[model samples]
Structure formats: C-alpha cells, structure tokens
Target: MTDTDSLVADLRFAEPDNPYLRDPGTSFHPVDELDPETAREQAAVLRDAVREHDARYYTDADPLVSDAVYDTLFERLQTLEETFDLDREGSPTRRVGGETLDELDTVAHVTRMLSIQQSVDADEVREFDDRVHREVGDVSYVCEPKFDGLSVEVVYVDGVYTRAATRGDGDEGEDVTEQVRTIRSIPERLAGDPPGFLAVRGEVYVPRPAFREHNRERVERGEEPFANPRNLAAGTLRQLDVSAVADRPLDCYFYDVLGWRATAPATAEPFSEVEDDDSRPDTQRAETAALDRFGLRTVDRSEHVGEIDGALDYRDRLLDDREELDYEIDGVVIKVDDRAAREELGATSRAIRWAFAYKFPARREVTRVTDVVVQVGRTGRLTPVALLDPVDVGGVTVARASLHNPEQIAELGVGVGDRVRVKRAGDVIPQVTEVVDDGDDGHFEFPDTCPVCDSPAERDGPVAFCTGGLSCDAQVARTIQHYASRGGLDIEGLGEERVEQLREAGLLDNLPDLYRLPERRGALAGLGGWGETSADNLIAEVRASREPPLPEFLAGLGIHEVGEATARNLAREFGDFETFRSATVDELVAVDDVGETVARTIREFLDNPDNAAVIDELLGFVDPESVETDDDGDALAGLTFVFTGSLSEPRRVASDLVERHGGSATGSVSGNTDYLVAGENPGQSKRDDADSEDVPVVDEDGFADVLAERGVDWPPAE
Candidate 1:
C-alpha cells in the first residue's frame, strides 16, 4: 500500500487532470526537482494560497488568476511534496479541502463517510474482482455512471425529510435541512413509512438538460458557466432557502445506505449497480430494490455484472449511454458489491479507498481563429482573445476564447486569421490548446505596448499590463467604472454609461474625485444632460457613498490583486482600514487566505504617498460602516440565488451591497457570509463551492431572515 508520503509523490508525478488546474505545460516545475524540506514548506505555502483561491474562484466566482494559473500552482505544489518528505495533513497537493468549517452548525452523522473501493480502468476492476473473490469467495461489484454531482446525506423522520447535508469531510456538514426541503425530487413528505428514521445517502445532481440551458443563458449574458452538471447539482442543494431550490431542475441517485431506523438498520441493502448479471436477488439486493421502490432515486440496479471484465465493458457502454442520459457523468464509478466485503475493505480519512473516479479526458475540437481582440481588464491588463468561427468543444461553443496574454498568442503562433486547435482544456474555459498551422500572410506581430493607453507594456513573467494607473484615461475610465461599480461605491446614478458620460464631460477623474462633486453641486446641478434635480441626486448619491464600510472602502480603491470578495476577507480579519494598511507582510499573510505575494502587493500599494492620500480622503468623508452588509441593501441585494445560467451582476454586487450594509457582500460562501445573493441561474461553480463551504441560500424572505438575524431584533425605531 502506498503510504501518504508515497501517494503524494505519485501525485507529484501525476499531471493534474482537472481543467481548473490549467496552466502552461512548458513551464511545469516537476515535483521531483524539489528537496524534501523545500517540498514541505512549498506544500504549506501553496496549500494556504490554493485554498483561498478556491474559495474565491469556486465559491465566489472571484479569481485572481486564470484557471490555468491555479492549476499550475496546484500541480507544482503536489510535485514538490510528492518527490520529497513534505506531505502535510493540510497539504495543498491533496486537492481535497479545508478543515471542516466552524461556522456550519455541527451535525453528527449516523454513519461515517464510508470508503469506496476503486477501479480506474478495466484492468483495475478485474484486479478488484480477483481480490474480492479470494476474500469473500465469489462476490460481485456494482458499477454506475457516478453522476458528476454532490454527495448528499438525507434523513427522513417518519417519512418526512428531517434534514439534508453536504458530504463535508464525510462526517458533519452545514445542516442544509431548510434548503433540501425545496428539492421536489427529494420529497419532503416521503412515500410509505420511511422506516421510522431513515438516513439515506445519495448523489444529488442537476440534469444535463438543465445544465445545458443554464450555461447557454450564462454564456449569452457574460457570466461564468458551471463546469458540469455535478457541480450545479451540488451547489443547488446547499441553498439556504429551499424555495431557491424549487426553481431548479434537480434530481438524485441513491447509492449507499448510510443509516436506517432501528428496525431497518439490521437489514442490509445491496450496493447499487452491482456486478451480478444473473441476479436472483440475495436478500440484500431485495432490500435495495424495496428502498428504490420507496422513491429514493436509486441507480438502475439491473445493470450490474459478475465478471470485472464484463463490468468494464458495461462501464464503457455506460459512458456512451451518458450521451443519451439526461444527467451528467464525468466517468463510471465502480464500487464493491458484497455488503460484508465492503465493510471489511474499509475507508480512509479523505476519500473512500475502495472507490475511484475514472474521469474522461477533456473533450477537444479544432476551430479557426477568425479574428483577435485585445481585451483590457478592470486592472488595465491587455489580454489577447481568439474570436473563433463558433465550433462546439466539450458541449459548449468555442468562440471568442481568451489567449490570456501575448505570449500565449506567440506560443500558439496564431494571429488575426489562422487555423488553430481550440479545446476546453479542463472541461471548463475554452482556450486555443495548440496551433495546427501558420496559415497567415505573415508571422504574428505581438503588441509592444498597451493598446488603449499606448503605455510601454512590460512582460513580468507570463503576464503583460498597462503601467499607467492614474494618468491614462482608459485606466481611469476602468478604475472609476470599477469604483462606481456595484462592488465598489454602488452609486445609483453612476453605471458604466454614466461613468463614460462623466469622463467625457470631465466631471469625474478618479474614485476619490467623485466626492468633490457634492461640494461643486452648483456646477453639477447644471450640466448639459442633467437638470438641477438629477444633478443633485447624483451629488447626494456620491455623498451617501462616502460613508462606506471598511470592506467596501477597501474594494473601491481598485488595488491590484484585490477584488470585493478578497477585500471583505481582508477587512474582516484586519478589523479596520488603517490596521490593514499598517499590517506587516507576516501579519497580512497570517490571514487565512492572504499569501506573501498578496501581502507584499498590499503593503507596496499602501506605502505609496498618493495611494495613502486616497485612503485618507475616504476616511475624512465619513465614519466606517458595518463589516458585513445585509438584506436591506441596494434593491438588488440579499436575494437567495442559484444562477441557472447568467445575469447582469457581472460580479459587481460585492461592491454595491457593501455601501448599503455599511459592510461588504462577497462572492463565495462561508459560515460568516450573510447570503448567496445571486442572479439569473448562477453557474454551479459558486453553488458547488458554497455547498462544500456550508453557507446558506436566501431569497428575499430569507434575506429578511438574515437582516433580522443581524440587528433587526426590534422594529424600526419609529
């Protein structure tokens, strides 16, 4: 058996196969290269960094790096620890999750998150069967398309659902009892007597049909899409308010039975999809059928086969069948069949040692680069994008994919009009995987400077950026646009259109200058497009925005390596704006998510006299507001959310909600978060991360519940 250290080393050698681990393959720092001590330190450092990024990226849809970069960092961390003696309990190399969150009200499981016996391929399955036959003397195994979704524990008290929780650490989880109640398939009121108190464990998922429609809307609207149905399903179940779950098209597949009533507990249920083609049910199989008849969405039991080879053949057939099936499946999940043998095989601290996920390769397709565009990000970085001729790759369109940077363009050797092989590298974001041709009139001429500001761009590593921060109008336009953004000041009258108008009219220069308009109300009150009333309203909004919470205030500043979500995390830990600014590198890094790089960037930004002056000016405008905002936010705030597809949020609510609450609303979920305020059908990305993190969902009513939870203990002081 591979000890934890040997396994980590194997992981180091293994190419991280997930799309989220996307990065340049050429620069991979093999884990074998690092010495033992260095591997350990690297593991700890990267573990903290990756966890923070995952929380921000998956839970909040707020990422500081592209998916490729995250993958790159994660894989390298794995490599270092695996090749050396550097494995930690909390090693980022494991790619599992953080320590069980404390915020979730504790729940003790009736049964432990049991281990799964695994088979990655047909050969492994045969080996598994060989061993099972030797031990249990002619036993079987169950195989099923492990629906790519979340593992759920369902508790029914006398045929009525008592509780539902995510498979957090396979122990206790955030009690999402309220949210699960809304899942129509879950049946809050079960059929027949559900064995007094039945605790059923199953995989809850969003159907592929729903997932496709959801992502279509997301794509059209410019919101992030869920990677797969499994992610969407997992995210959906964790909604704080069950009503939010009602709108979603969700379903479940019962696999293992974690617990049952005192009377039923003694009875064993056959493993789902057991490998017994010639099944005249042994008593356990009969019980499994009976349980399924009672309305737990159990897998199709008849598909099980006796021979491991036959099962692999069945597994392959199942993968093909997945194309026709309504639900999503990443791979075939094979588990031990005999009930007694499964118990003997046992489990592990993290995943089930018995079961394994044999993920399919990311779907790839070829497409031509019809055109190229340089998109200027909020931070003024010019990223090259490929405008494709619209081809489908990995069940999604491959048009207008990000090249990431100029170097990416050169590496692919692609230009304005060239043929390229585009792929959804990790079944996630679409990128030009490689260039198949140099089909062009000439070689690609990479931009030497910023396209918009014409600033001399410098490549510091793999990224290129416009260095003119405050001086360039393009930079200022983006900055002010970001400042007045919903995640920033949340000024009602200052959306991008209004920001453009102000910038064009020379009414606003930067974030801090907006405060000046209130003083110059007379001038603002008589602008060409605005009447006295409208101008005064704008002035008032700007004045009102001045009294921001520390989080919102920090986010509004538009610092590099910071977003509203990250800002809120920093503020909560630091307490106030001044203290955050004064913190040392060590102190900043001490925050759960903040790393040395983030800490240094923050310190460097604060040290600038110009930057400090902006903070000082913001301080003078008014007292700091709340640390965590609430339901009584801008009209769009505190809405219980599950974005099936997309919406207009564009990741701005973080800023907008902050101004309203005298605190901040962030992107991801944690015990401390107020709500999963969402729009449209948000991608499963946030929901999945939230489910794992154990945050509650809320609709308008739930929002009210949270507000009342916060300080609405008494009616308005009227």
Candidate 2:
C-alpha cells in the first residue's frame, strides 16, 4: 500500500458536516484521524481509488459518482480513517470483497461476511452499544431493520432454494440464480429438512404498496417511473426476462444465517464467540431469533431495539407514526447485543464492530423549472423534458425530469424561471443535473422543430433528434406506450392508463385500435385493478398478441430508426413480411451492419402509405414467421460479425446467431467485422475493439467449432 502512500491517499478529502448537500463533500469522507504519514497516504489513495471506482461503479455499468456521490466519497473515506489515526491495512478499510462474475459462477463462502458498522443517530447507536459494553462486559441482544432493499445471498441446498447473491463488495455476487427463480418468497423446496449448505443473508424489497402500485403503473404507462422502491427492487431482480421477473410481486426477508451445518449439533462456540462464557447458539436467541426459525421475513419486531432510548423511540416512531411506511425504512438498524460483545467488537473493512445505521436525511428536491418540454424518443432522441413544480423527494412525487440531451439542455441551463437541481437520476429517473440560476430571466426557447411533428430537430452528441417519424403524436404516443409494453406487447388491458382512457374516451386512435378492444370489454372489466377475470384476462391478452415475434412484430411497428436491436436485425435478415417490406435504402445498405442511419430508417419505414396501410393491415392479423436458415447457404454466408462478452444468448440472440449463418450483426468491432465473437469477461475496450479490427477471436465454444466446420448441425450443446 505504498508508492508514496498511493500518492498521498490521492490527495485525500471529506468536507460536509451538513448543508442541504445536493452532492456535498461530493461523496465525502476522510476524517478517520490520520498520521502514520497521513495513514499511509490515505490507505494508498483509498485502496487505489476504491478499486478503480468499484470498477467504474459496479463492473462498468459506468458510474463515477451518483450513488449520492458514491455515498459521499464513501463517508469521507469513513471520516478520514476515523479522525486521522488512518487505519491502513490496505484500507477501503480492508476491502469487503468482490471479483467473481465471469458471467457469474463462483460461490466460495464457508462464512466470512462481517461488515455492517454505521451511524447517523440515536447518539451513534449509543456510541455503538457503548463500545460493545466497553469490550465484552454483560451482553445479549440482536436488532434488525435497515432494509432499503437489494442485498440477497440465499444458498439453501438441502432445505432447497439454491442461489441468489448480490452484496457484491461483501463477497462475490450477481449470480441471481436465474433471477432467483422468479421469487415468490423464494422457496423452490425448503419446508423443513434443510440446513446442509444453507447460506441465508436477506433483503429484496418493492413493497410500499408495491412501490406505489409500481409507480402508478409507470406514470399511467407513459413509462419510466421507478427511482425508488430500490430501483424497482433492483430492476425487478435484474430481469433479462425470467418471465419478466415472474410478473413482479417480489418479496423476501430472511436476515442472517450463513452456512448452517444442521445448526451445529444444535451451538458450543457460544453464538460464535466475544467471551462472558463465550459459547451460546444451541437454542437461538437473536440474529432475528436465528432467522425466525428458518422461514425468513423478520424486520418487523416493532422496529427491533434494546434501547438507545429504544432506538430513538423507534426512530421518532418512524418520523412520527410511521411516515406512511408500507415499505422503505431508509434508517434504523441498531445491532450488537453481545454475541460476545459482537465478537469482542470486531470488523471495519466497511462496517460493524457492533452495528449502527440510524441514517435518513438526503433524498433532495427544490423544483421550479415550469416548462422545458422536448421529449420524442424511440431513438428519434430529443429528450430535454423538465416541467417540474411538484417536489416530495424521497417519499416520491417528483413532477417530471430528464434533461438528458441538448447536452443536458445546454449543460443544465434549465430555463423557464430556473432554480432547479433535481436528483433521482440513476436512482431510477428524474434528472435535471443543475441550473440553480443565471438570472437574465432564466432563458428557454430551444425548439428548432417537431413540437409533435413539425419535423426537423436533429443533433446527436448530447442527443436531440425528432425527424418526426411517421407523424409524431408525441412520438406516436411514446411508441404506442412502448407497444403495449411491460417490455413491449404485454398488451393486457392496454395502459398509459388505458391509453389515457382511450385518449379521453374518443376511444384510442391507433395500433389498430389496440386490437379491436371488443369495444372496450365492459370498460376493461370496469377498470380499477380490473375484474371479471381481469376483463377475460384482458381480452385473452389481446388475443395472445395476435401471435407476435417477428422480433415482436417489428417492435410493435413504431419503426422509424427501429430498435429492439434493430427489430432483431430486421427480423433475422429479411426472411418475411415481404422481405422486410421489399428492402431498399440500397437494400438496407447491403445488410452487414446496415447503417446510413439505419438504412435511411429502413427506407423511411417502408415509405409510409399510412405505414403501408398499417403494414398491410398488420399482415392480415399476424404471421411473418421465418426462423432464418435460407441465409443462402454456408461458411457464415455473407460474413460480418461483432459481439463481445457474456453471451449464452441475448445481444439479440447474438444477432440471431449472426443472422443464423448468413452473418451480419455489428455494434462496434469495426473495419467491417467478419468475426469477433469473444465471450465470458471480454472488455479491455472490447479487447481493443478486436485488436484494432483484425477481428477473429470466436468462443461460445468457438461458434460450435465454426458450426461443425460448416456442415452446420450445432443445436445440441445446450
């Protein structure tokens, strides 16, 4: 941990003591009292800048700050190593843990998590349970609640449920066992005989009346709500559509069991050791009474506590009579009741010598910008958006946000009487990065076209598009609300709240009248959580979405610059719907990575004659079925490939497995990629874009040994 103490703990910092910090001490931290040469150069520049910004915020989903400024520079490098004694044993305070994800398959944890120390109030959880009863004196407690959600771990084996993970820097994670086998209180088998390889660890929420009925059905289907309820319970448990996270009602609670070898011949190391006759767990008295005798669900022991004035009188009775909590605690955890003075007061790589979290005070909002509209997405970009005035911050409400392009509306020059500065951004949605004020009557007027189809608004690089594809009715009602979305075409009772009650009851004006709504099936089974078998199961899910898939019927025909991976690479290389409606824009720029702005937006959406009479009356009610293969013969036909890592399918099924042989699927590795496949962990900037485009690599078992050396029969390996 040297090299001139990682260049003086990369010039350490940590300033905010408090001031409505909208990003103060901008992720503060650095007061741990230092001096062994500034705690060995601030633990070698905070363990090499928090492991390269935790690998650019969680394995490169790219973040650099905004987890409220990486938890205020991880609590000012935990208060400059707790008031400058700078405890550097290679500190991020001795790393919690990570590094497994080769598309997830590493498990190793025969017990060693130990990291939960916190403090925000109740006199720092009573000076951390009075320095753990002044280091092991008279103890016996356990309190738990701190669940804002998403810290799983699970395991089980003999008692059944098999795997769940994601406490990342606590040990390895991201192996969401096929999205925790679609959650339903996670049981896959254990009713009793379990304890064999049983790991346990808890949390995975959403509740708060299912996060305000899933953000009021994503703002009545104009789609995009979630910046709370722990990012829709961490994007519905990382969905890559495990049946869309088994129709979302996800919930789990557990608490803390960790590798239960049939309850240690029932404890003798005394609840695992701190001393006062240190050796107890033979009967379970708390880690929420040994994870509530193995069945889970434990954060409600009347907000558990043993006193810090009864956990600040149960956190001021949850901000006075439970701040309408149906879910979402954001504070009150308080632990350490002698498991031998919490193991003679151990831990500090990230948290816990005896527990403390009391925390709850920075969700922010100051709203004002009354008008800044622009919108238009579906790849016709144009964002800008704003419109605020509402407010509420953490308890949710936020009127409207997203100044994401127009270079964040001229780098946050957010006009219309400014005084803006919202948050939520990567917490879920709301954005407006900043525009506090510029006087000169806080400017505005940015338009340059398409106020719903006045056409021409093009930019790109800090985005702005709107060449008004197929006549924009607000980008065709946000692409038919992402084509009756729930991730495209889930159709059921059509949303955006019944497409604005069928556009103010003039009875919906598009997407072939949302499939002949049988004249609104008794007003969608009399709406309001709809009934009568949910309106005959929403006209049998809109007649099973007139049998979709031709890449979800060309992503529900919102076409113009088509996306959904370019409508599944134009439905796996034009094999139907009249060869992609008689291809042209130079025959989709002669296919391999079609471009010229997606072949002039697939030749202006097949030269719209009212979208080719709604694609020939929706191909006379659906059936463009052509599962590739005539990709005209073999050796990867007209070659051109790309893909990078973690692909056992998805990157639009590896561009329909390179247009199923007659290759053509590009998204980066350039110089006309004729093969760059590479798999598993790949990304040193996509192996330097396939070594400066000499592209060759391969793997998914070397594209099945180049499809059995071209005799092509590769489907048997799954």
Report backbone clashes per prediction: 38, 43
Model 2 lowest lDDT segment of ten: 269-278
> Per-residue lDDT for 316-421 in model 1, tens only?
7776665457666657766666666665656666665445555544444765564565655557676776655456686775555778877777767777557678
State the displacement of the C-alpha of residue 682, model 1, in Å, after optimal TM-score superposition. 44
lDDT of 1: 0.60
The residue-by-residue lDDT of candidate 2 on 1-718, one tens digit each, is: 9643543332212112222122234533334343457655654554445444443332233444567665555556666666666644424332222222235554544345556756565566677667776777645444445777787777655454556666766656566776665554454444333454456777888766666555544432335655567777887666555655667766767666555564432322122221112122432245455454444545554443455677766666665433345566666666655454555577777666766677665436875664566656545676666655456666777767877667556656668657677888667887877777654555666688756556667665656676655455555556667777744565755666667666655445656666666667777666566678867876777778777767767766666556566677667667676777888787777665567887886676567455677567656766646656356355577777776777666555556655666666766777777677777886678678777767787777887677677765544334
TM-score: which candidate is best? 1
User: After aligning candidate 2 to the native by TM-score, how far in Å is the CA of 395 from where it should be?
Assistant: 7.7
Per-model TM-score on C-alpha atoms: 0.41, 0.33
